[model samples]
Target: MFYLGIDVAKAKLDCYLLTQLEPLKGKAKVVTNTTKGLADLLIWLTKNHIPHDQLHVTLEATGVYHELAATQLHDAGVCVSIANPAQIKHFGQGLAVRTKTAGVDSQVLARYCAMIKPAAWTPPPPEARILKGFLARREAILQDLLREQNRQEKAESTVTPELIHQSINDSITFLNAQLKKLQSQIDDHIDRHPGLKNDLD
Candidate 1:
């Protein structure tokens, strides 16, 4: 299996393609960190005569920067391994890598993956990701509502001015409405996306 190593960054992805496992060396390329860039990367692979099913892409997780590429490749039927950062680092250390450059790091990643054959990682499906976003917003609104409630309670218990209590009460009411609206939106979204509903069920 051909291994492709990617060193993910916020702005670009440094890649090293390992056509053969013997030397852990091949072509190096840089692509922007975006969907368009991923598309171009696929085109590059096809131009190299590499099929999606035969490609094994590996990269160390760098915050959320790696997620987009992983998801895109996985969806395109490419095997993707999100290597453990610590493990990748140790593997690179074993190689005695001197200066850390995009090219060097990507080369190390390619070598480690070619030898270790790390387990493939799967990102959440699109429907699941949507639900996650909704859930995150819901949690944030809940936290805000709780804070407002706490403030209201304190105001009622202390010598706080009446206007302060009224303001807190208004905030609590607004938050409640927002929570209800958000929940409705979430429900509607799930209904629109059967996969999400099925997952929840």
Candidate 2:
């Protein structure tokens, strides 16, 4: 059996492949948060002769960065496990591995998987996924609006340009509209999904 561990980030994935009687092998691969990246990963795995069913894959739950990949892998019939980063860090402390890099992190994950053999986590249902997407988009828009507001305030005493104020107002208005739409969609989605509605209640 092959143990695959991944250190996931927003822009790239550090992958480690561990097998018995061999030195640890790892590679840092760039992957976008999109279907193309998911397809590429599947292709790479196939080329390497890694059986999706036989491979035990583990990655840290570094927020939503790991969600898409985990969902894709699980849907493809691979055994996938997500570990809490804090737990993984504590485990690494036991091994006295202090330094942190993508490669080292990947190796640590591989070793952790080998030791703990965590059970796979099933992805949330489709409605929950949609709700999560809406929430994330709304949060992103709010963040952008906040950044623009900060910029506008910083330039208040320096420039006092009418155009800058207009731009800031326009951005805020746009973000508000987007947030409203997302909220409505999320509410409707949660209402329709009894599981999520129950969880919220």
Candidate 3:
């Protein structure tokens, strides 16, 4: 089996290949984290004679950045595993790696997969994925609300412009409405799944 370790970032993906015979043998490639990049990666792997079935891809769970690649690869019939970053970090420590970079991280991930052969990761259900997206958006809105509220409080203390105060109040009101909408949707989503509801509770 050929192990393809991908170190994902917001803009690019760094990849390294590993095999049982030569666990640390392969060149690394950097590509954008997009559909075109994923296609290019597939082409590169194909040119190198690594068939889809022989390919075992692994990457750390890097927030939502890794999701697109993971989902795309899984859809394309490639074996994919989304490993925990902490697990990968500990594995790197085991290898006595002091320096860390995208290249080095990909190498470590490749080696870890080659040695351990982690279980394949199945994509989460559509409902779960949707709920996760909602939660992330809600958190962002909440943060925005907090910042606006702080600005409002500061405006109240200082001799700020009236327009600025009005704008802040308007933003706070809009964010509050958004939060309530998100909360209702989240509650409805959780109610649809007993397991999720129980876990959340």
Candidate 4:
């Protein structure tokens, strides 16, 4: 099987197409990180004479940056694996990859895929993805609330201005409202998805 290693970033993807592992033969190409770009990547594979079934695409789990590529590639019948950041780091280290450029990262990932053949990734259900997004936003709101609370406490200890206190209180109030709304949404979502609730429970 051929391996395609992609170093995903916010704006673009650095792809390394591995033809062989021994002696390490690969060709690098970059594409925009968008729906059109993913389609273009498919055409690139065709031009390179690589079929989808024979292709094993591996990419790092770079927050939501890698999601589109992973989901699209999986849907396009290409074998896709999402490697954890830690796994990629350690694996690159094992291969003695010193340079930290995007190109080098793609090459290392290509090598890792060819050698290790990690497990394939199944895209999460839509409900799960939605819930994850909600939870992530909730966490951010909670962090904002905590920071505001901390600031208020610190300001109280100091001879801070009344306006600063008001500002802090306002932020805390907004964050609390957001958190409450998000929690309610989460609960409503759980009620809507019995299977998800069962799995979580």
Candidate whose lDDT is highest: 4
**Per-prediction TM-score:** 0.75, 0.74, 0.80, 0.78
Compared with the true structure, what per-residue lDDT tens digits does model 3 show for residues 1-201? Answer: 888899999999999977453534787889999999999999889988999888889999997899999998998889998899999999999999989999999999888888888999999877888888888899999999999999999999999999999999999999999999999999888888757765555
Looking at candidate 2, the ten consecutive residues that score lowest on lDDT are 21-30
Candidate 3 local lDDT, residue 172? 99
Top candidate, metric TM-score: 3
Report per-prediction Cα RMSD to one decimal.
3.9, 3.8, 2.9, 3.1
Query: For model 1, what is the C-alpha lDDT against the true structure?
Result: 0.90
Off by over 4 Å in 2: 21-34, 96-99, 140-173
Global Cα lDDT for candidate 4: 0.93
Q: How far in Å is the alpha carbon of 1 misplaced in model 4?
A: 4.4
How does candidate 2 fare on TM-score?
A: 0.74
User: Poorest 10 consecutive residues of model 1 by lDDT?
Assistant: 16-25
User: Each prediction's Cα lDDT score?
Assistant: 0.90, 0.80, 0.90, 0.93
Candidate 1 regions off by >4 Å?
21-24, 139-178, 188-201
**Count of clashing residue pairs in every prediction:** 0, 0, 0, 0
Instruction: Say what the RMSD of model 4 is.
Output: 3.1
What's the distance in Å from true for residue 41, model 2? 2.7
